[model samples]
Target: MKKRVWRSGLMANQGFNFQKEHPGIALCGLDCYACPRYHTIGSSRCPGCAGKYFSEKHPSCGFISCAFKHGRLESCGLCPEIDTCNRITRLKTVIKDQPGYPSYQNRIANLIKIKGTGFEAFADTCIHKEALLKTLIDKYNDGRKKAFYCRAVQLLPLPDLENLLDENAKKGYKSVDDAALAVSNSLKELANKLGIEVC
Candidate 1:
């Protein structure tokens, strides 16, 4: 498989690394590239699960310590015991119980996709997702809506997000605040129509 490594967009030193591991895709299947923490400007940012200084920038995670760090694999889905992994099963159970955290819900399916397509191909999709998120962070972010934009980009389909952005681009805004509000409303409307939980 071809390694579709990409340079970081808005976050060159922030995250989106391509050193030896894929910073976009996590071992547990979180889209780290689309995470709010990855886009944080003021606070100390999360450099992604596999990003540079990952062990230093972020807290010590059980998932990494237990499985990921011991091997060279980019994801737990590559493990032979993925189907019988107790930690992953429990993690999925926790995710299922958390209705407020919609992003976590995508992890299991993402892991399965990694298993089928391999890390490189699955990460190709993640790079595209990150690109969409990067566009929002770079243009639409009004210093406060980073998290909201991240959630919207993560939950919504790529085509839907692309179309929404294209539609919004044709409109005029008075200021950064106006631009933010306009996109916010549009994103909410899209979320409602799609029955997507973006909080």
Candidate 2:
């Protein structure tokens, strides 16, 4: 039996559609685009799960390798066997109650959204959140607030998140430190009002 190649290599050899289908979402439904590492520059930057250079960055990501085994599927959520999959069970156990980066908590929600709205729509939603997250990173990252910022954008509604970002932009700041603190506080207040706990 011939070995089956997947992702970028397969895209080059076979015009694989999975790589292009919804680029930033992982097979297990993590929002790669919202991750701080995805926003980092230089060699440390992650290209998102199953994203370009992903094979180089995370060649052993179990879910991606699993998708390769499962007929080149784009997302595990699309798999018929998702409900019974031990991998997802493991994932839920692993991501539970981590102190920071609550964005990872969105994994199951992202999968459910993918199941409900399809990949294209889910991609659009991720893209919108990515743009918002980039703005937060570019303007308000105090070198310590990236995780909170990521969680805020992931957990908050787009219009509300965007509104807070815009509101923060118009405020005067004595320094970037002040600006970063204000942005964190603003998002925190919004998070509190929504009962979402972005911290």
Candidate 1 structure quality by residue, lDDT tens digits, 1-199 = 1333333232333322223367667788888887888777654887777677776676556566545334656788888888998989998898878765555878899889888988788787678878878887887878888888888887888888889988888888888888888898899999999998676
Candidate 2: C-alpha lDDT:
0.76
Candidate 2: the clashing residue pairs are none
Question: Cα lDDT for residue 59, model 2?
Answer: 39
Q: Give each model's clash number.
A: 0, 0
Off by over 4 Å in 1: 1-20, 65-71
Best prediction by TM-score: 1
Candidate 2 at residue 23, lDDT? 55
Query: How large an RMSD does model 2 have?
Result: 4.1
Off by over 4 Å in 2: 1-21, 69-71, 92-100
TM-score of 2: 0.79
C-alpha TM-score for every candidate: 0.80, 0.79
Q: What lDDT would each prediction earn against the true structure?
A: 0.76, 0.76
